[model samples]
Target: MIVKTKAIVFSAIKYSEADLIVCCFTQDVGIKTYLLRNILKSKKSNLKTSYFQPLTQLDIVATNKDKGTLEYIREAKVLLPYSSLHTNIVKSSLVLFLAEMLKNCLREEEPNPILYMFLEESLQWLDEHEGVGNFHIYFLLRLSHFIGFYPDASNMKHDYFNILEGNFQETKTSEYCLEGETVENFKHFFNISVDDISSIKLSKTSRANLLELLLTYFKLHVQGYQRPKSLSIINQLFV
Candidate 1:
């Protein structure tokens, strides 16, 4: 079936010299990877290579077989052309890190409107906003909800957090427990808004440690999840 939908480019990989393998998360379909034949060399092709950049939002008309095989994109255009997401050094680095993350963690092949909109609106916000050094961290925290392991903060008064179990606890039951000021920083994001991100301040050390903890949580919950290789890039830029 041919369907037109909004998608976010996760990553584009070069294939067989000139062709490209583009994996995208569509708003209508969960995840669809397309084979772009000779897009690198065929300038006449309507699908420009730039549209496949990490986390680039697009409107795509694609063929979906739903058979666990690669599909093809007949036509695609930038749905929301970013003004600063690709140009600004900080935002671009975060984009790369976040893009690699989506590719690694997101794998459902069925439509999820809630997850789609969360990503769509958030990308637009990132492109338009300033002072988003912690945006990637916030993004990952929220992504856990869709991926099915959001922290259980109902008992936030607890002294520790069990990263593996994702619950607030009064005692450290095992090595996966997080305590002290780190617990406070992690809890600061429980039910906060993007606009409120700037309200909470963390030094560079706190930021790095908090990100590491989040990554650990994802690794425990998400099978086959790997930390993005571009993480070091954003780690340096966000500082």
Candidate 2:
């Protein structure tokens, strides 16, 4: 069957001399891999391999066998063309880091419209906005809501945030706790929206520490989530 859907490119691996195995998260199908034969063979090819860059949003007409095997796209075009995501160096690095995080964390094989919509809208916002130093921090924080581990911030007045428990506690009882400046910054984000993320500023060191803590929180709650290797590169870029 033919399906028209919107997909976010997660990662593309060169399969052979001229082929690419592209993994994408589709609004209609959660996670799908497509074999794009000869997409990289020539500049004259109808399917420009550039369309498959990390985190690009595309509108595609694809063949869906729905058989748990590799599918193929018959037609594809940019759905939401980014203004500066790929061209701006800082924004590009952010996209790369985000793509790697998504690749590691998004493992579902079924459609999740809510998650898809959140990603689609969020990326568009990232592209349009400036001063995005805090983008990834808030992005991952919001993502936890869909992944089932968004921090419980109802007790926001507490002095300590228990990472393993995913909530604020009156007192720290374990090693997995956020205290002092880190707790202040982390808790500030719990109630923020995407429009307000950039306003929650941090120094380079503070930002790096917060990212580490967020990944630690993820590792504790998510069974298979791995800290993204692109993390250091992103931190270095912002520095």
RMSD to the true structure for each prediction, in A, is: 1.0, 1.4
Q: Write the per-residue lDDT of candidate 2 for residues 45-132, one digit (tens) a residue.
A: 6678889999999999899898988999988998888999999999999999999989888988899999999999899999999989
Give me the overall lDDT of model 2.
0.89
C-alpha lDDT score of every prediction, in listed order: 0.91, 0.89
Clashing pairs in 1: none
lDDT for residue 187 in candidate 1, whole number 0-100: 90
Task: Give, for candidate 2, the lowest lDDT window spanning 10 residues.
Answer: 39-48
Q: Residues 100-179, candidate 1: write the lDDT tens digits.
A: 89889999888999999999999999999999977877899999998999898999999899998999999899999989
lDDT of model number 1: 0.91
